[model samples]
Target: MSNPVLEIKNLHVWYRTYGGYSRVLDGVNLHVYKGEKVGLVGEAGCGKTTTMRSVLRILPEGQAHIPEGQILYHGNDILKMKPRELQQVRTRGISMIFQEPAAALNPVFTVGTQMFDVIKYSGLSKEESRKDNIKRLAIQAIKEVYIPDPERILNCYPNQLSGGMKQRICIAMAIVTARELLIADEPGTSLDVTIQDQVHRLLRGLVEKKEMSLIMITHSLGVARELTDRIYVMYAGNIVEVARTSDLFANPLHPYTLGLLSSVPKLTGGGVAEGIYGRIPDYLRPPGGCRFHPRCPRAVQRCREEKPLLRDLGDGHQVACFQV
Candidate 1:
């Protein structure tokens, strides 16, 4: 295969809190090629958002920091870049969609004002860029996500729109830049089931149509299975499994992967879904070896003593467990 558009190697991000230091992302390694769609699935607080934040270099200032590892975009190390270079990357290279729309948007600014500002900063001329261009892109983007009355919605404030509408608008803003890599941090989180499905479809279409790479952070395996070419299973800031979508669903090697699959709710089943037994270990004082060992049903004595490197199992599939 050709080289990936973006590659993350051994990413480690942590925060300094009142109690002590908390490591949220530890040794996260993955790659995203042009036109590829990759889904990252994990339970809440499993470092899914942290991983995405690391890529954007927007980790909470002072509170969280990328202590180790390199983020490479098209073979260039993003971490090593200067400030101006990084600013260019934010505008022209990589873009992000936050999980919550209301939180992302400026309540004080009109939607048109913010959207036009982004467009103007992107190198478009003022004459070429007006309320019309803003409305055009905003409407087109919102409509692509299946939101109705795009023109009317564009004029409305974030508070005026429902949660689902706001989410769609946020998605439109992210894709409007037409950047090479789009990092979506749970774009469908607050929407209803029907709206969630529409958001998923819109995301898939955006990737296919633009040939843009996507790193979708979500908790839904169903969405992952439907939209991603590959899937990475994470737990407690560690990536436990990386594999092609079909191979992952068919033969999940890591205990965490199996546990996640078992937890997926069934539509017409007679029994309740089985949940993972233990909670994620505290990042401030994580386990000595594999982070998942405490909760892994298949964990053995060795699992408690040694952390495993990601081992290749052929066909780009890898697992990080001695037992696997």
Candidate 2:
């Protein structure tokens, strides 16, 4: 396999509060090869978004601290990059589609204004930065997302557009600037079911067409199965399992992963879906050893005293639990 477009190694993040620091991400390790779509699946507050935000170095500086980690973008460490280098990365190397479309766009600016600004600053050459050229590129990008009447849509404000339309516009902006990796933090959120499907399909098509690596953070296991090549199952700030999407679904290893898969409602109408027994552990005072030990049915004394590192189980499947 070729080198990964993005790699995160031994990442640990914390948030400072009156009650000391909260451990948000603990020893997270992940990678995305070129053109491969990877899924990060976990319940809310599992540090999925924190991991992505750390990749972009977008975490709030005063509140968030990274005591250990390396975020490598094509072999370069993003955490140590200078401002100019970081700016270049933000403009051309990677882009993120935030969860809320309405919050991402500025209500004060017209869609064209925002789109043109993004295109202009997206590492464009002096000759390509002209107003006319930027407008043309913006229109072309909007067209790619299957939005109709690009010109008219561009002229409208974000408030005037529907939720789906705003999301497509956000997608257009992301693709226009993102040359290597696109981090989508729940792009289909807050939309109708039908529109959500359309957005997911559009994202998959765009990633394939552009040959860009993707990290799709979604709560829906069904969406993860449908869209990603590989899946990483997270639990309370740690990655409990990693495997090919098909393998993870067919034979989940970690106890947490099993719970997640079992909780999903079956379309074929099996009785009530089984829910995970316990809620996520509190970050300020998380369980000592394996974070999921408190909720795991098969947990032993070892699981309660010593944290388990991810162990390879052949064929690139890995789980961080002793019983597995």
Candidate 3:
């Protein structure tokens, strides 16, 4: 196989709080092949957002620290890249579509102004960067997500548009740069079911059309299963399972993965799926050994005393569970 478009190895990130440092991402291992869609799925506060932020190098100033692991892009270490190199990566290589479009856009400026700034910031020439190109690109992006009348929409302020419309605009801006990798942090979170499906399809279309790899973070298992070729199940910042979508769903080894799959609402007469009992452990002082042991139905004594390393079980499927 060709080299992966992006790779992350044992990424450990922490946030310094008034009380203590909270381990937000602990040894997260993930990768995205060129033109592949990889899903990062987990409950809220499970470090899904933090992992995306780490890749973008947009962690709040002086708040989060990378204590361990390496993030590689085209075989280069992202953690070691200089400021200029990282900027190039952020602009020419990778772009992000944040979850909240309202928060992502500038309330003070028109959409056109903001988009022009983004395009110029990515190193476009002022002379070559015509207003028509900016407007056309923006409209095309908005139209790709099935938004109505992209021309009029581009002229409006972010606050003037609906939440779903704003999200499409965010996606448009991210992909309009023609970056090789797109990090979508809950791109469909706020939209209704019909609109969500439209946006989801639009995202997949964008990745396929541009041959760009996508790292989509979401809590929706259905979304992950439908869009991503590979799925990573994260719990309290730890990646417990990594497998192809079909293989993981057909034969999930880790108890956490099983619990997550079981919770997905099914269409058959099985009624509403049951949720995993217990809450996510506080990151300030998470559980020792296996973090999921407390909630794992099949957890044994080994799970409480020793943390399991991710062991490949052939065919590229991996799991971190002593019982498995």
What is the TM-score of each predicted model, taking all chains together? 0.94, 0.99, 0.95
Candidate 2 regions off by >4 Å?
A: none
Best by lDDT: 2
Report the lDDT tens digits of candidate 2 across residue range 1-324: 999999999999999989999998989999999999999999999999999999999999999999999999999999999999999899999999999999999999999999999998898899989899899899999999999999999999999999999999999999985589999999997899999999999999999999998999998899999999999989889998999999998898788888877888788878766687889998999999898998998999999899999999999999999997
Please list all clashing residue pairs in model 2, or write none if there are none. none
Ranking by lDDT: 2, 3, 1
CA lDDT, every model vs. true structure: 0.85, 0.93, 0.87
| CA deviation > 4 Å runs, candidate 1 | 125-135
What is the Cα-based lDDT of residue 132 in candidate 1? 78
* Cα deviation of 146, candidate 1, in Å: 3.9
**10 residues in a row with least lDDT, candidate 3:** 120-129
Give the local distance difference test score of model 1: 0.85
lDDT tens per residue, model 1, 1-324: 899999999999889999799988889998999989999999999999988887778878989877899999888888899988888888888888888888998888777667767766765567756767766876677677777777677677778877877777777787775789998888888788898888788888987888899999999888899889999999899898999999999988888888888788778676766688979889999997899988888888888989888999999999999986
Alpha carbon lDDT of residue 158, candidate 1?
76
